[model samples]
Target: MPTLKTLQPGDEPLLEAFLWQHADTSMFLRSNCRAAGLLDEGARFQGTYVAAYINEAIVAVAAHFWNGMVIVQAPVHLAEVVQAAVTQSGRAIAGISGPAAQVEATKSVLGLSNRPTQLDESEILFSLTLADLQIPPALGAKQVQCRFPHSDELELLCEWCAAYNIEALGQKETSSLQPACRQIIEARQATSVHWVLVAENTLVSYSAFNAALPDIVQIGGVWTPPALRGKGYAKCVVAGSLLEARSHGVKRAILFTSDDKQAAQAVYRGIGFVPTGEKYGLVLFEG
Candidate 1:
């Protein structure tokens, strides 16, 4: 039987070892957990990290928080460790899972329905094998340039990101994301993270990669300005960023997007991102 336990500092090495064995599924979460750990130390947000141990061996892990709504990520086993995690939080939990089967299993266990929504059903997780990545030649009327932001561009980058988040989250200007954006900018100053900004004569979209692990690089925070939609800017930026990952000796690149956005899904497929499987994003509501 598998037992679920809270994550602590002493478990880092053991968890890291588990992650090393199951890098494909755990890489992204591990990287995010490491970043979140730093944020927790700074008192940014408190998080509950848990691991599932089977016969004293770590098999699965998850991390969540009690911010306004409960948000969980990549719950490998929704019926097992995930349910325990949600129950412990004592809040309505929302998360992403592998596929219809796994999702339905979670729903049946939790007594909920798989009502897909714009935010909830967002992109299927996609990946490209490093050996399969084809570096397409730069083309078209739109110029594509990719670079890591320097100290001088940090302020402008943060401002651009704030605007991007407001539009993406569909929240008003007063949202707390403003400071979260600042935190990300500050985090980039450290060597563990990389921020790639794609500019077409000006900053248009940005993508970030956390390089805590040597073999896998997770792509996240991909955003394009509202005015820049349908201009092929997203495709250009994604391609450029993937190319950069290859240059950095990364063997795999992984990312997720809303499943409802067919156009964005097409864009990822066009650029060679094959859907590995479905990933769940679960949110817990506070009673």
Candidate 2:
């Protein structure tokens, strides 16, 4: 039987090794850990790390952080690790997210009701390799300049980030996200990369690297206003962003989008991202 262990202060190397092993598929878990050490630190680092071991060999890892959201990157059989972590932490999680079946199985073991406050069932995971990057052609005769947000544009990026949360993640009541978003913008500006698509001095689309693992970076918070859809801004911005990341020595990029987001999927595919798996997410409220 596998044993569950809460990572300690000195376990950084062990956790890094585990995450590096599954970096491509579990980029979120790995990147988040790298961005913030395995200790609770407000919104970004608000979590703990749990590992599952079989006879001293680490086989699975998870994060119970930020509103009790548990993100696991273990096999289906090891879901008990997630349940045990949640139960031990005594935190009423806002949600659980990961591979589809794994999330459901963990939820079951945790005795969480199937009727969650919010559920996203159609998340498709896609990844791109540095092997064959197909940079999308510029949209048209109209030039779309893609670059990082200037200092003065931080508020504009925050608004787009909020809109992304509300529209993509179904976060209707996200007054709390403003402060977190501000922190996020600052963190990204300092540690990671942010890319924006501007047409004629107007922001049209946005995307950024959420985490940077040893050889992989996860792309997230991609958004374009409804009024600007179907014009290849997403494709252009993503392509440019990937190129920038590569220039900085990243070897791979991964992103998740709703399954029905055919337009976004098309944009990703056009830039060499291939569907690899599905992700599941649920939100529970504190009663």
Candidate 3:
């Protein structure tokens, strides 16, 4: 069995090298680590980053966040090693998310009490290579109108995101969400931006390339106002986001959607995203 080691302060450099070995799949883990490194207040999360090793060579990596979000990327059999590290941390796990088979495999060892109270099981993961990207010319150019909003638009962005959390992620609005949204909007990453879709001066939809590596970008927080959905706006905005990514020289992009969201899946396919696989897990909350 490989030994599990918790990452320490200076271990980031080494840990990063391990993560980049599979950068496309490890985008979430890498993104979280990079954000924590940049944000002064990120220390509050103090979540555990653990890796399994054999004879000094790193074999697998898992990030268990302060918010109880555990994301793992490794062979399905290594799920036991991941379970041990997470259980030993004694932190309450709010959820586990990863590649479909791997997340389900990990749950078997994580124990029943730690299972998710609410689950977004069977999530379809999709990707868009440069060749796969298809932006409807008129929608991408005119109707969608996607771009990075200025600082003056922060308040409206926050409000839209708060509503997004409620409708998309099934969470209530709180004081912290707005400030967090503000921070993301203010972040000046060379390759990242919060792309919002505006129609007739009103913010209608939005998406973000929250995590970017040398060749891949991970899309998240995609939302269209409830009243605005089903009108094909999301498809346009998502395509625009990918085009924006192409402009930044990113070769490919990834996003995840629940299997139950057929309409959402249709939107992505319309823009030329192909489903790669499904991830299964419980967003377990600690009682």
User: Which candidate leads the pack in TM-score?
Assistant: 2
Off by over 4 Å in 2: 41-43, 76-79, 139-142, 277-287
Q: What is the C-alpha local distance difference test score of each model?
A: 0.59, 0.74, 0.70
TM-score rank, highest first?
2, 3, 1
What's the TM-score of each model vs. the native?
0.72, 0.88, 0.82
TM accuracy, model 1: 0.72
Model 3 gets an lDDT of: 0.70
Q: Using lDDT, rank the candidates from best to worst.
A: 2, 3, 1
lDDT of 2 at 70: 82
Q: lDDT per residue, candidate 3, 82-184, as tens digits?
A: 7755765666666776666667666666764444453456577788896678877657569558777766777776777777766666664667767866655
Q: What 10-residue stretch in candidate 3 is worst by lDDT?
A: 37-46
Stronger candidate by TM-score (1 vs 2): 2
Native-referenced Cα lDDT, model 1: 0.59
Q: Give the runs in model 1 whose Cα sits over 4 Å from its true position.
A: 17-25, 34-46, 65-118, 139-143, 189-201, 210-212, 282-287
Q: What shift in Å separates residue 160 of candidate 3 from its native position after superposition?
A: 2.0
Model 2's TM-score against the true structure: 0.88
